[model samples]
Target: MKAISYSRYGGPEVLEYGDLREPKVGPDSVLVKVRAAAVNPVDWKAREGYLDPVLDAVFPVVPGWDVAGVVVGLGASVTEYAVGDEVIGYVREDFLSRGTFAEYVGAPVRTLARKPRNLTWEEAAGLPLTGLTAYQVLVKALRVQRGETVLVHAAAGGVGSIAVQLARHLGARVIGTANERNHDYVRSLGGEPVTYGEGLAERVRGLAPEGVDAAFDTIGGDTLKVSAQLLVPEGRLVSIADGDVVSYGGRYSFVRPDADDLTRLAELAEQGVVSVHVFETFPLERAADAYRRNEEGGTRGKIVVTVAWDTAGPDA
Candidate 1:
Protein backbone atom coordinates (compact mmCIF):
# COMPACT_ATOMS: atom_id res chain seq x y z
CA MET A 1 0.00 0.00 0.00
CA LYS A 2 1.17 3.57 -0.64
CA ALA A 3 1.65 5.55 2.57
CA ILE A 4 3.59 8.19 4.49
CA SER A 5 6.06 6.87 7.00
CA TYR A 6 9.26 7.69 8.90
CA SER A 7 11.99 5.25 9.81
CA ARG A 8 13.44 7.57 12.43
CA TYR A 9 12.07 10.32 14.60
CA GLY A 10 12.90 13.80 13.29
CA GLY A 11 11.38 16.72 11.47
CA PRO A 12 9.09 16.81 8.41
CA GLU A 13 12.10 15.87 6.29
CA VAL A 14 11.85 12.35 7.70
CA LEU A 15 8.33 11.61 6.39
CA GLU A 16 8.79 9.47 3.29
CA TYR A 17 5.90 8.88 0.91
CA GLY A 18 6.09 5.51 -0.80
CA ASP A 19 4.93 1.91 -0.83
CA LEU A 20 4.80 -0.21 2.31
CA ARG A 21 3.46 -3.63 3.27
CA GLU A 22 -0.29 -4.08 3.69
CA PRO A 23 -1.68 -4.58 7.15
CA LYS A 24 -3.29 -7.80 8.36
CA VAL A 25 -6.76 -7.82 9.88
CA GLY A 26 -6.79 -8.95 13.45
CA PRO A 27 -9.65 -10.69 15.26
CA ASP A 28 -10.72 -7.37 16.75
CA SER A 29 -9.87 -5.07 13.84
CA VAL A 30 -11.26 -4.12 10.44
CA LEU A 31 -9.36 -3.07 7.36
CA VAL A 32 -10.26 0.37 6.05
CA LYS A 33 -9.37 1.68 2.61
CA VAL A 34 -8.40 5.22 3.45
CA ARG A 35 -10.32 7.94 1.67
CA ALA A 36 -9.09 10.80 3.85
CA ALA A 37 -7.06 11.37 6.99
CA ALA A 38 -6.76 14.37 9.29
CA VAL A 39 -3.35 15.75 10.14
CA ASN A 40 -3.44 16.41 13.87
CA PRO A 41 -0.77 18.10 16.01
CA VAL A 42 -0.17 14.75 17.59
CA ASP A 43 0.79 13.34 14.20
CA TRP A 44 3.68 15.77 13.97
CA LYS A 45 4.39 15.38 17.66
CA ALA A 46 4.79 11.64 17.27
CA ARG A 47 6.90 12.15 14.18
CA GLU A 48 9.32 14.25 16.23
CA GLY A 49 9.53 11.74 19.11
CA TYR A 50 7.58 13.84 21.63
CA LEU A 51 5.50 10.78 22.50
CA ASP A 52 8.56 8.54 22.69
CA PRO A 53 8.31 7.87 26.41
CA VAL A 54 4.69 6.74 26.19
CA LEU A 55 4.45 4.92 22.85
CA ASP A 56 7.28 2.76 21.64
CA ALA A 57 7.93 3.18 17.93
CA VAL A 58 8.18 0.16 15.68
CA PHE A 59 10.39 2.00 13.20
CA PRO A 60 8.99 2.90 9.80
CA VAL A 61 5.93 4.28 11.62
CA VAL A 62 2.94 5.35 9.57
CA PRO A 63 1.63 8.44 11.40
CA GLY A 64 -2.02 9.46 11.51
CA TRP A 65 -5.04 8.75 13.72
CA ASP A 66 -8.21 10.37 12.39
CA VAL A 67 -9.58 8.66 9.28
CA ALA A 68 -12.74 8.62 7.16
CA GLY A 69 -12.76 5.60 4.89
CA VAL A 70 -14.58 2.48 3.69
CA VAL A 71 -14.38 -0.90 5.28
CA VAL A 72 -12.78 -3.30 2.82
CA GLY A 73 -12.47 -6.33 5.12
CA LEU A 74 -13.33 -7.29 8.65
CA GLY A 75 -11.83 -9.34 11.40
CA ALA A 76 -13.34 -12.69 12.34
CA SER A 77 -14.83 -11.31 15.53
CA VAL A 78 -16.04 -8.01 14.11
CA THR A 79 -19.74 -7.71 13.26
CA GLU A 80 -20.34 -4.02 13.80
CA TYR A 81 -19.36 -3.27 10.18
CA ALA A 82 -18.72 -5.02 6.88
CA VAL A 83 -17.37 -4.43 3.41
CA GLY A 84 -18.52 -1.23 1.68
CA ASP A 85 -19.59 0.56 4.87
CA GLU A 86 -18.20 4.07 5.15
CA VAL A 87 -16.63 4.69 8.58
CA ILE A 88 -14.50 7.06 10.59
CA GLY A 89 -11.97 6.06 13.17
CA TYR A 90 -9.36 7.38 15.59
CA VAL A 91 -7.15 4.45 14.65
CA ARG A 92 -4.60 4.69 17.48
CA GLU A 93 -2.62 1.76 18.72
CA ASP A 94 -0.54 1.39 21.91
CA PHE A 95 2.50 2.15 19.79
CA LEU A 96 3.60 4.23 16.83
CA SER A 97 2.75 2.05 13.83
CA ARG A 98 -0.06 0.88 11.54
CA GLY A 99 -1.68 4.31 11.33
CA THR A 100 -4.31 5.85 9.06
CA PHE A 101 -1.90 7.81 6.80
CA ALA A 102 -1.68 4.71 4.64
CA GLU A 103 -3.99 3.45 1.91
CA TYR A 104 -5.38 0.92 4.38
CA VAL A 105 -5.39 0.67 8.17
CA GLY A 106 -6.41 -2.21 10.42
CA ALA A 107 -8.58 -0.37 12.90
CA PRO A 108 -9.77 -1.98 16.09
CA VAL A 109 -13.57 -2.05 16.38
CA ARG A 110 -13.39 0.15 19.46
CA THR A 111 -12.06 3.03 17.38
CA LEU A 112 -14.59 2.94 14.54
CA ALA A 113 -17.83 4.88 14.05
CA ARG A 114 -20.26 5.39 11.18
CA LYS A 115 -19.39 8.46 9.15
CA PRO A 116 -21.84 11.31 9.54
CA ARG A 117 -23.81 11.63 6.32
CA ASN A 118 -23.78 15.39 6.61
CA LEU A 119 -19.99 15.60 6.50
CA THR A 120 -17.75 15.32 3.46
CA TRP A 121 -15.14 12.57 3.66
CA GLU A 122 -12.48 15.19 4.50
CA GLU A 123 -14.69 16.74 7.16
CA ALA A 124 -15.58 13.34 8.61
CA ALA A 125 -11.89 12.56 8.89
CA GLY A 126 -11.48 15.54 11.25
CA LEU A 127 -14.22 14.52 13.67
CA PRO A 128 -13.05 11.55 15.72
CA LEU A 129 -10.01 12.77 17.66
CA THR A 130 -10.95 16.42 18.04
CA GLY A 131 -14.62 15.63 18.64
CA LEU A 132 -13.90 12.95 21.19
CA THR A 133 -11.38 15.15 22.98
CA ALA A 134 -13.80 18.04 23.25
CA TYR A 135 -16.74 15.82 24.19
CA GLN A 136 -14.91 13.82 26.81
CA VAL A 137 -13.41 16.85 28.50
CA LEU A 138 -16.69 18.75 28.52
CA VAL A 139 -18.97 15.88 29.61
CA LYS A 140 -16.69 13.87 31.85
CA ALA A 141 -13.81 15.99 33.06
CA LEU A 142 -15.43 19.40 33.36
CA ARG A 143 -19.06 18.27 33.81
CA VAL A 144 -20.25 21.59 32.41
CA GLN A 145 -23.91 22.22 33.22
CA ARG A 146 -26.79 24.21 31.82
CA GLY A 147 -26.54 27.98 32.20
CA GLU A 148 -22.95 27.81 33.35
CA THR A 149 -20.30 30.10 31.91
CA VAL A 150 -17.39 28.18 30.40
CA LEU A 151 -14.00 29.40 29.19
CA VAL A 152 -12.39 27.54 26.28
CA HIS A 153 -8.87 28.36 25.18
CA ALA A 154 -7.95 28.31 21.49
CA ALA A 155 -11.66 28.14 20.69
CA ALA A 156 -11.28 28.47 16.93
CA GLY A 157 -8.80 25.62 16.61
CA GLY A 158 -9.76 22.00 15.97
CA VAL A 159 -10.60 20.81 19.50
CA GLY A 160 -11.74 24.21 20.70
CA SER A 161 -14.08 24.73 17.74
CA ILE A 162 -15.89 21.51 18.56
CA ALA A 163 -15.76 22.28 22.27
CA VAL A 164 -17.59 25.55 21.76
CA GLN A 165 -20.41 23.88 19.83
CA LEU A 166 -20.73 20.92 22.20
CA ALA A 167 -20.58 23.12 25.27
CA ARG A 168 -23.35 25.27 23.85
CA HIS A 169 -25.39 22.11 23.29
CA LEU A 170 -24.94 21.31 27.00
CA GLY A 171 -26.39 24.77 27.70
CA ALA A 172 -23.18 26.37 28.87
CA ARG A 173 -22.37 29.87 27.69
CA VAL A 174 -18.96 29.62 26.04
CA ILE A 175 -16.17 32.21 25.97
CA GLY A 176 -13.55 31.21 23.42
CA THR A 177 -10.03 32.58 22.93
CA ALA A 178 -8.65 33.34 19.50
CA ASN A 179 -6.89 36.09 17.63
CA GLU A 180 -8.85 39.22 16.70
CA ARG A 181 -9.16 37.80 13.20
CA ASN A 182 -11.03 34.69 14.36
CA HIS A 183 -13.39 36.34 16.83
CA ASP A 184 -16.17 36.30 14.25
CA TYR A 185 -15.49 32.65 13.58
CA VAL A 186 -15.71 31.87 17.27
CA ARG A 187 -19.02 33.70 17.57
CA SER A 188 -20.34 31.62 14.69
CA LEU A 189 -19.64 28.53 16.78
CA GLY A 190 -21.91 29.96 19.50
CA GLY A 191 -19.07 31.23 21.69
CA GLU A 192 -18.47 34.74 22.86
CA PRO A 193 -15.06 35.64 21.51
CA VAL A 194 -12.20 36.82 23.72
CA THR A 195 -8.79 37.72 22.32
CA TYR A 196 -6.20 35.57 24.00
CA GLY A 197 -2.85 36.68 25.50
CA GLU A 198 -2.24 39.40 28.06
CA GLY A 199 -5.23 40.27 30.23
CA LEU A 200 -6.99 37.04 29.19
CA ALA A 201 -8.29 36.48 32.68
CA GLU A 202 -9.58 40.02 32.83
CA ARG A 203 -11.31 39.67 29.47
CA VAL A 204 -13.01 36.49 30.62
CA ARG A 205 -14.03 38.27 33.80
CA GLY A 206 -15.52 41.06 31.71
CA LEU A 207 -17.85 38.47 30.18
CA ALA A 208 -18.61 36.75 33.49
CA PRO A 209 -17.65 39.00 36.38
CA GLU A 210 -17.84 36.18 38.88
CA GLY A 211 -15.55 33.97 36.78
CA VAL A 212 -16.52 30.89 34.77
CA ASP A 213 -18.13 27.70 36.03
CA ALA A 214 -15.84 25.51 33.95
CA ALA A 215 -12.82 25.94 31.73
CA PHE A 216 -11.46 23.82 28.87
CA ASP A 217 -7.80 24.55 28.16
CA THR A 218 -6.44 23.32 24.83
CA ILE A 219 -3.40 25.58 24.87
CA GLY A 220 -1.55 24.93 28.03
CA GLY A 221 1.35 26.82 29.68
CA ASP A 222 0.36 30.46 30.20
CA THR A 223 -3.12 29.91 28.82
CA LEU A 224 -3.78 27.15 31.31
CA LYS A 225 -2.69 29.45 34.10
CA VAL A 226 -5.05 32.14 32.84
CA SER A 227 -7.90 29.66 32.68
CA ALA A 228 -7.23 28.51 36.23
CA GLN A 229 -7.43 32.06 37.42
CA LEU A 230 -10.70 32.69 35.56
CA LEU A 231 -12.66 29.90 37.22
CA VAL A 232 -15.22 30.42 39.96
CA PRO A 233 -14.75 28.64 43.24
CA GLU A 234 -14.79 24.88 42.73
CA GLY A 235 -15.18 25.47 39.01
CA ARG A 236 -13.96 22.56 36.90
CA LEU A 237 -10.92 22.74 34.62
CA VAL A 238 -9.38 20.27 32.17
CA SER A 239 -6.31 20.50 29.97
CA ILE A 240 -5.13 18.15 27.23
CA ALA A 241 -2.00 20.02 26.34
CA ASP A 242 -0.25 19.92 29.69
CA GLY A 243 -0.28 17.48 32.58
CA ASP A 244 0.64 20.23 35.03
CA VAL A 245 -3.05 21.08 35.23
CA VAL A 246 -3.14 18.72 38.19
CA SER A 247 -1.27 21.32 40.18
CA TYR A 248 -4.05 23.83 39.59
CA GLY A 249 -6.75 21.52 40.99
CA GLY A 250 -7.67 20.53 37.44
CA ARG A 251 -7.58 17.24 35.59
CA TYR A 252 -5.29 16.54 32.65
CA SER A 253 -7.04 14.48 30.01
CA PHE A 254 -6.10 12.36 27.01
CA VAL A 255 -8.71 11.46 24.42
CA ARG A 256 -9.69 7.78 24.34
CA PRO A 257 -11.09 5.64 21.54
CA ASP A 258 -14.67 4.91 22.53
CA ALA A 259 -17.04 3.73 19.80
CA ASP A 260 -20.04 4.84 21.83
CA ASP A 261 -18.63 8.35 22.22
CA LEU A 262 -17.62 8.56 18.57
CA THR A 263 -21.13 7.47 17.61
CA ARG A 264 -22.68 10.22 19.73
CA LEU A 265 -20.41 12.79 18.05
CA ALA A 266 -21.49 11.45 14.67
CA GLU A 267 -25.10 11.81 15.74
CA LEU A 268 -24.45 15.39 16.76
CA ALA A 269 -22.78 16.09 13.43
CA GLU A 270 -25.73 14.57 11.57
CA GLN A 271 -28.23 16.55 13.62
CA GLY A 272 -26.43 19.77 12.78
CA VAL A 273 -25.64 20.43 16.42
CA VAL A 274 -21.94 20.42 15.54
CA SER A 275 -19.99 20.53 12.28
CA VAL A 276 -16.35 20.22 11.26
CA HIS A 277 -14.77 23.05 9.33
CA VAL A 278 -12.21 21.80 6.85
CA PHE A 279 -9.62 24.54 6.64
CA GLU A 280 -7.50 22.80 4.01
CA THR A 281 -6.65 19.49 2.41
CA PHE A 282 -3.66 17.91 0.62
CA PRO A 283 -3.18 14.77 -1.40
CA LEU A 284 -1.72 11.71 0.35
CA GLU A 285 1.60 12.19 -1.40
CA ARG A 286 1.90 15.67 0.05
CA ALA A 287 1.48 14.46 3.65
CA ALA A 288 4.74 16.07 4.73
CA ASP A 289 3.34 19.43 3.74
CA ALA A 290 0.22 18.62 5.75
CA TYR A 291 2.35 17.93 8.79
CA ARG A 292 4.22 21.18 8.33
CA ARG A 293 0.94 23.08 8.02
CA ASN A 294 -0.36 21.60 11.26
CA GLU A 295 2.90 22.28 13.01
CA GLU A 296 2.72 25.92 11.98
CA GLY A 297 -0.36 26.16 14.24
CA GLY A 298 -3.20 28.75 14.15
CA THR A 299 -5.30 26.38 12.01
CA ARG A 300 -9.01 27.26 12.20
CA GLY A 301 -10.33 23.74 11.84
CA LYS A 302 -8.58 20.72 10.32
CA ILE A 303 -5.88 20.03 7.73
CA VAL A 304 -6.78 16.81 5.95
CA VAL A 305 -4.85 14.45 3.65
CA THR A 306 -6.78 12.70 0.91
CA VAL A 307 -6.08 9.38 -0.78
CA ALA A 308 -7.31 8.92 -4.34
CA TRP A 309 -5.53 5.97 -5.85
CA ASP A 310 -6.76 6.74 -9.34
CA THR A 311 -5.57 10.33 -9.18
CA ALA A 312 -2.43 10.23 -7.03
CA GLY A 313 0.71 11.41 -8.79
CA PRO A 314 4.38 10.86 -8.10
CA ASP A 315 5.65 12.25 -4.80
CA ALA A 316 7.29 15.66 -4.84
Candidate 2:
Protein backbone atom coordinates (compact mmCIF):
# COMPACT_ATOMS: atom_id res chain seq x y z
CA MET A 1 0.00 0.00 0.00
CA LYS A 2 1.01 3.60 -0.59
CA ALA A 3 0.58 6.15 2.18
CA ILE A 4 1.46 9.71 3.03
CA SER A 5 3.05 10.04 6.44
CA TYR A 6 5.39 12.16 8.47
CA SER A 7 8.23 10.98 10.64
CA ARG A 8 8.12 14.35 12.40
CA TYR A 9 5.69 17.25 12.65
CA GLY A 10 6.30 20.66 11.23
CA GLY A 11 4.74 21.90 7.97
CA PRO A 12 3.15 20.42 4.87
CA GLU A 13 6.68 19.55 3.83
CA VAL A 14 6.69 16.98 6.59
CA LEU A 15 4.18 14.81 4.71
CA GLU A 16 5.91 12.09 2.69
CA TYR A 17 4.41 9.72 0.13
CA GLY A 18 5.85 6.22 -0.29
CA ASP A 19 5.07 2.56 -0.26
CA LEU A 20 3.95 1.11 3.08
CA ARG A 21 2.59 -2.14 4.44
CA GLU A 22 -1.18 -2.65 4.46
CA PRO A 23 -3.09 -2.17 7.72
CA LYS A 24 -4.07 -5.14 9.83
CA VAL A 25 -7.67 -5.18 11.06
CA GLY A 26 -8.49 -5.60 14.72
CA PRO A 27 -11.28 -7.62 16.29
CA ASP A 28 -13.61 -4.57 16.50
CA SER A 29 -12.38 -2.63 13.46
CA VAL A 30 -13.17 -2.40 9.76
CA LEU A 31 -10.59 -2.10 6.99
CA VAL A 32 -11.65 0.46 4.41
CA LYS A 33 -10.33 0.70 0.86
CA VAL A 34 -9.68 4.42 0.82
CA ARG A 35 -11.55 6.14 -1.97
CA ALA A 36 -11.33 9.70 -0.72
CA ALA A 37 -10.33 11.67 2.36
CA ALA A 38 -11.24 15.10 3.67
CA VAL A 39 -8.72 17.69 4.80
CA ASN A 40 -9.69 19.96 7.68
CA PRO A 41 -7.89 22.63 9.67
CA VAL A 42 -7.36 19.89 12.19
CA ASP A 43 -5.17 18.04 9.67
CA TRP A 44 -2.81 20.97 9.36
CA LYS A 45 -3.04 21.69 13.08
CA ALA A 46 -2.07 18.13 13.82
CA ARG A 47 0.78 18.38 11.36
CA GLU A 48 2.04 21.39 13.30
CA GLY A 49 1.90 19.55 16.61
CA TYR A 50 -0.93 21.69 18.00
CA LEU A 51 -2.72 18.49 19.09
CA ASP A 52 0.44 16.95 20.59
CA PRO A 53 -0.86 16.77 24.13
CA VAL A 54 -4.32 15.51 23.28
CA LEU A 55 -3.37 13.07 20.52
CA ASP A 56 -0.12 12.03 22.25
CA ALA A 57 1.28 10.84 18.96
CA VAL A 58 4.59 9.06 18.48
CA PHE A 59 6.71 10.18 15.54
CA PRO A 60 5.58 9.30 11.98
CA VAL A 61 1.94 10.43 12.13
CA VAL A 62 -0.62 10.19 9.33
CA PRO A 63 -2.57 13.44 9.25
CA GLY A 64 -6.10 12.86 8.04
CA TRP A 65 -9.32 12.25 10.05
CA ASP A 66 -12.13 11.99 7.47
CA VAL A 67 -12.70 8.94 5.29
CA ALA A 68 -15.35 8.05 2.68
CA GLY A 69 -14.79 4.68 1.15
CA VAL A 70 -15.88 1.10 0.50
CA VAL A 71 -15.43 -1.58 3.11
CA VAL A 72 -13.42 -4.47 1.69
CA GLY A 73 -13.12 -6.34 5.01
CA LEU A 74 -14.49 -6.23 8.52
CA GLY A 75 -13.73 -7.68 11.91
CA ALA A 76 -15.18 -11.06 12.79
CA SER A 77 -17.53 -9.51 15.36
CA VAL A 78 -18.83 -6.73 13.08
CA THR A 79 -22.50 -7.11 12.15
CA GLU A 80 -23.56 -3.62 11.08
CA TYR A 81 -21.66 -3.77 7.78
CA ALA A 82 -20.45 -6.39 5.36
CA VAL A 83 -17.81 -6.41 2.68
CA GLY A 84 -18.43 -3.79 -0.07
CA ASP A 85 -20.56 -1.42 2.01
CA GLU A 86 -20.01 2.27 1.28
CA VAL A 87 -19.27 4.30 4.41
CA ILE A 88 -17.99 7.53 5.89
CA GLY A 89 -16.67 8.47 9.31
CA TYR A 90 -14.79 10.89 11.54
CA VAL A 91 -11.86 8.95 12.95
CA ARG A 92 -11.43 9.25 16.69
CA GLU A 93 -9.00 12.15 17.19
CA ASP A 94 -7.50 11.49 20.62
CA PHE A 95 -5.69 8.35 19.47
CA LEU A 96 -3.18 8.99 16.72
CA SER A 97 -2.51 5.99 14.54
CA ARG A 98 -2.36 5.68 10.76
CA GLY A 99 -5.19 7.89 9.48
CA THR A 100 -7.23 8.28 6.29
CA PHE A 101 -4.17 9.46 4.36
CA ALA A 102 -3.27 5.89 3.57
CA GLU A 103 -4.49 3.53 0.91
CA TYR A 104 -6.24 1.47 3.58
CA VAL A 105 -6.88 2.26 7.23
CA GLY A 106 -8.60 0.57 10.13
CA ALA A 107 -11.60 2.29 11.71
CA PRO A 108 -13.82 1.28 14.58
CA VAL A 109 -17.34 0.24 13.54
CA ARG A 110 -18.92 2.54 16.13
CA THR A 111 -17.51 5.69 14.49
CA LEU A 112 -18.40 4.68 10.95
CA ALA A 113 -21.81 4.91 9.24
CA ARG A 114 -23.44 4.26 5.91
CA LYS A 115 -22.51 6.91 3.37
CA PRO A 116 -25.29 9.10 2.02
CA ARG A 117 -26.48 7.74 -1.31
CA ASN A 118 -26.82 11.26 -2.66
CA LEU A 119 -23.17 12.26 -2.31
CA THR A 120 -20.20 11.45 -4.51
CA TRP A 121 -17.10 9.90 -3.00
CA GLU A 122 -15.34 13.28 -2.98
CA GLU A 123 -18.31 15.08 -1.45
CA ALA A 124 -18.95 12.35 1.09
CA ALA A 125 -15.29 12.42 1.98
CA GLY A 126 -15.63 16.07 3.01
CA LEU A 127 -18.58 15.58 5.35
CA PRO A 128 -17.70 13.45 8.37
CA LEU A 129 -15.57 15.57 10.65
CA THR A 130 -16.98 18.93 9.60
CA GLY A 131 -20.59 17.79 9.44
CA LEU A 132 -20.43 16.01 12.78
CA THR A 133 -18.88 19.09 14.34
CA ALA A 134 -21.61 21.37 13.02
CA TYR A 135 -24.43 19.02 14.02
CA GLN A 136 -23.07 18.55 17.52
CA VAL A 137 -22.50 22.26 18.09
CA LEU A 138 -25.93 23.46 16.93
CA VAL A 139 -28.22 20.58 17.89
CA LYS A 140 -26.52 19.48 21.09
CA ALA A 141 -24.16 22.02 22.61
CA LEU A 142 -26.06 25.18 21.77
CA ARG A 143 -29.56 23.68 21.85
CA VAL A 144 -30.70 25.91 19.00
CA GLN A 145 -34.42 26.48 18.73
CA ARG A 146 -36.93 27.37 16.08
CA GLY A 147 -37.41 31.07 15.35
CA GLU A 148 -34.20 31.98 17.11
CA THR A 149 -31.31 33.94 15.57
CA VAL A 150 -28.09 31.93 15.08
CA LEU A 151 -24.81 33.47 14.08
CA VAL A 152 -22.03 31.30 12.61
CA HIS A 153 -18.55 32.69 12.30
CA ALA A 154 -16.50 31.65 9.25
CA ALA A 155 -19.70 30.37 7.73
CA ALA A 156 -18.27 29.68 4.29
CA GLY A 157 -15.46 27.57 5.64
CA GLY A 158 -15.64 23.80 6.12
CA VAL A 159 -17.64 23.46 9.34
CA GLY A 160 -19.32 26.85 8.98
CA SER A 161 -20.96 25.95 5.67
CA ILE A 162 -22.71 22.96 7.22
CA ALA A 163 -23.51 24.83 10.42
CA VAL A 164 -25.37 27.50 8.45
CA GLN A 165 -27.45 24.93 6.60
CA LEU A 166 -28.19 22.90 9.75
CA ALA A 167 -29.29 26.00 11.62
CA ARG A 168 -31.67 26.87 8.78
CA HIS A 169 -33.13 23.36 8.78
CA LEU A 170 -33.80 23.66 12.49
CA GLY A 171 -35.90 26.80 11.75
CA ALA A 172 -33.40 29.33 13.06
CA ARG A 173 -32.74 32.55 11.22
CA VAL A 174 -29.18 31.92 10.16
CA ILE A 175 -26.56 34.63 9.92
CA GLY A 176 -23.10 33.61 8.69
CA THR A 177 -19.71 35.31 8.68
CA ALA A 178 -17.43 35.16 5.65
CA ASN A 179 -15.45 37.62 3.61
CA GLU A 180 -17.11 39.72 0.87
CA ARG A 181 -16.02 37.11 -1.68
CA ASN A 182 -18.15 34.32 -0.18
CA HIS A 183 -21.24 36.27 0.91
CA ASP A 184 -23.31 35.02 -2.02
CA TYR A 185 -22.24 31.43 -1.38
CA VAL A 186 -23.24 31.76 2.26
CA ARG A 187 -26.57 33.32 1.31
CA SER A 188 -27.27 30.34 -0.94
CA LEU A 189 -27.03 28.15 2.16
CA GLY A 190 -30.06 29.95 3.70
CA GLY A 191 -28.06 32.49 5.64
CA GLU A 192 -27.88 36.25 5.72
CA PRO A 193 -24.15 36.55 5.08
CA VAL A 194 -22.03 39.11 6.90
CA THR A 195 -18.41 39.95 6.09
CA TYR A 196 -16.26 38.78 8.94
CA GLY A 197 -13.12 40.75 10.09
CA GLU A 198 -13.56 44.19 11.70
CA GLY A 199 -16.83 45.18 13.30
CA LEU A 200 -18.36 41.73 13.00
CA ALA A 201 -20.56 42.56 15.94
CA GLU A 202 -22.00 45.62 14.19
CA ARG A 203 -22.63 43.67 11.01
CA VAL A 204 -24.45 40.99 12.99
CA ARG A 205 -26.32 43.60 15.03
CA GLY A 206 -27.67 45.18 11.88
CA LEU A 207 -29.09 41.82 10.86
CA ALA A 208 -30.27 40.73 14.29
CA PRO A 209 -31.46 43.80 16.14
CA GLU A 210 -32.94 41.66 18.91
CA GLY A 211 -29.57 39.96 19.53
CA VAL A 212 -28.46 36.50 18.52
CA ASP A 213 -29.72 33.45 20.39
CA ALA A 214 -26.53 31.44 19.83
CA ALA A 215 -23.17 31.55 18.07
CA PHE A 216 -20.94 28.86 16.53
CA ASP A 217 -17.39 30.11 16.23
CA THR A 218 -15.24 28.02 13.91
CA ILE A 219 -12.39 30.52 13.83
CA GLY A 220 -11.08 31.21 17.27
CA GLY A 221 -8.89 34.03 18.64
CA ASP A 222 -10.48 37.35 17.67
CA THR A 223 -13.43 35.68 16.02
CA LEU A 224 -14.24 33.92 19.27
CA LYS A 225 -13.74 37.19 21.14
CA VAL A 226 -16.04 39.03 18.74
CA SER A 227 -18.66 36.27 18.69
CA ALA A 228 -19.21 36.74 22.41
CA GLN A 229 -20.78 40.15 21.75
CA LEU A 230 -23.34 38.86 19.21
CA LEU A 231 -25.20 36.69 21.70
CA VAL A 232 -28.00 37.76 24.03
CA PRO A 233 -27.58 37.31 27.76
CA GLU A 234 -26.94 33.66 28.64
CA GLY A 235 -26.84 32.76 24.94
CA ARG A 236 -24.70 29.79 23.92
CA LEU A 237 -21.27 30.36 22.35
CA VAL A 238 -19.19 27.34 21.31
CA SER A 239 -15.80 26.98 19.59
CA ILE A 240 -14.63 23.61 18.28
CA ALA A 241 -11.73 24.69 16.07
CA ASP A 242 -9.83 25.98 19.05
CA GLY A 243 -7.36 23.78 20.88
CA ASP A 244 -8.77 25.01 24.17
CA VAL A 245 -12.23 26.18 25.09
CA VAL A 246 -12.75 29.92 25.14
CA SER A 247 -14.46 31.17 28.30
CA TYR A 248 -17.03 33.60 26.94
CA GLY A 249 -19.48 33.61 29.87
CA GLY A 250 -21.67 31.24 27.89
CA ARG A 251 -21.65 27.62 26.78
CA TYR A 252 -18.27 26.72 25.27
CA SER A 253 -17.97 23.33 23.62
CA PHE A 254 -15.72 20.79 21.93
CA VAL A 255 -17.14 18.53 19.20
CA ARG A 256 -17.37 14.82 20.04
CA PRO A 257 -18.69 12.16 17.70
CA ASP A 258 -21.88 10.46 18.83
CA ALA A 259 -23.41 7.70 16.73
CA ASP A 260 -26.84 9.32 17.03
CA ASP A 261 -25.62 12.73 15.83
CA LEU A 262 -23.94 11.25 12.73
CA THR A 263 -27.12 9.33 11.94
CA ARG A 264 -29.13 12.55 12.03
CA LEU A 265 -26.69 14.28 9.67
CA ALA A 266 -26.91 11.35 7.28
CA GLU A 267 -30.70 11.54 7.45
CA LEU A 268 -30.60 15.26 6.61
CA ALA A 269 -28.32 14.60 3.65
CA GLU A 270 -30.58 11.80 2.49
CA GLN A 271 -33.67 14.03 2.63
CA GLY A 272 -32.00 16.92 0.77
CA VAL A 273 -32.38 19.10 3.85
CA VAL A 274 -28.63 19.70 3.84
CA SER A 275 -26.08 19.75 1.03
CA VAL A 276 -22.40 18.84 1.20
CA HIS A 277 -20.42 21.46 -0.66
CA VAL A 278 -16.95 20.35 -1.74
CA PHE A 279 -14.91 23.28 -3.00
CA GLU A 280 -11.75 21.48 -4.13
CA THR A 281 -10.25 18.04 -4.61
CA PHE A 282 -6.61 17.00 -4.78
CA PRO A 283 -5.02 13.67 -5.45
CA LEU A 284 -3.36 12.21 -2.39
CA GLU A 285 -0.04 12.84 -4.10
CA ARG A 286 -0.81 16.55 -4.23
CA ALA A 287 -1.66 16.89 -0.56
CA ALA A 288 0.92 19.62 -0.16
CA ASP A 289 -0.92 21.73 -2.71
CA ALA A 290 -4.19 21.15 -0.88
CA TYR A 291 -2.65 22.32 2.33
CA ARG A 292 -1.46 25.52 0.64
CA ARG A 293 -4.96 26.23 -0.66
CA ASN A 294 -6.61 25.54 2.71
CA GLU A 295 -4.08 27.80 4.42
CA GLU A 296 -5.18 30.64 2.15
CA GLY A 297 -8.52 30.55 4.02
CA GLY A 298 -10.67 31.87 1.17
CA THR A 299 -12.36 28.63 0.16
CA ARG A 300 -16.16 28.68 -0.01
CA GLY A 301 -16.46 25.16 1.38
CA LYS A 302 -14.47 22.05 2.23
CA ILE A 303 -11.27 20.78 0.58
CA VAL A 304 -10.67 17.06 0.07
CA VAL A 305 -7.94 14.63 -0.93
CA THR A 306 -9.25 11.97 -3.30
CA VAL A 307 -7.20 8.78 -3.04
CA ALA A 308 -7.05 7.06 -6.42
CA TRP A 309 -9.18 3.93 -6.56
CA ASP A 310 -8.85 3.06 -10.25
CA THR A 311 -5.92 0.78 -9.44
CA ALA A 312 -5.62 -1.24 -6.27
CA GLY A 313 -3.87 -4.19 -4.52
CA PRO A 314 -0.21 -3.61 -5.31
CA ASP A 315 -0.78 -3.76 -9.06
CA ALA A 316 -0.83 -0.07 -9.94
Question: How much is the lDDT of residue 209 in candidate 2?
Answer: 82
Question: What is candidate 2's lDDT per residue for 80-194, written digit by digit as tens?
Answer: 8898899898877576667888888888887788899999998888888889888888987898999999999888888889999999999999999888989889989999998
RMSD of each: 2.5, 1.7
Single out the weakest 10-residue window by summed lDDT for candidate 1: 307-316
Question: Would you list the clashing residue pairs of candidate 1?
Answer: none
TM-score of each: 0.97, 0.95
lDDT by residue for model 1 (1-316), tens: 8999999999999999999988989999998889999999988888899999999999889999999999888899998998889999998989998899989889999999999998999999999999999999999888889999999889999999999999999999999999999999999999999997788888888889999999898889999888888888889989999999999999999999999999999999999999999999999999999988988988899999999854332231
CA lDDT, every prediction?
0.92, 0.83
Q: Which stretches of candidate 2 lie over 4 Å from their true place?
A: 242-246, 311-316
lDDT of 1 at 165: 99
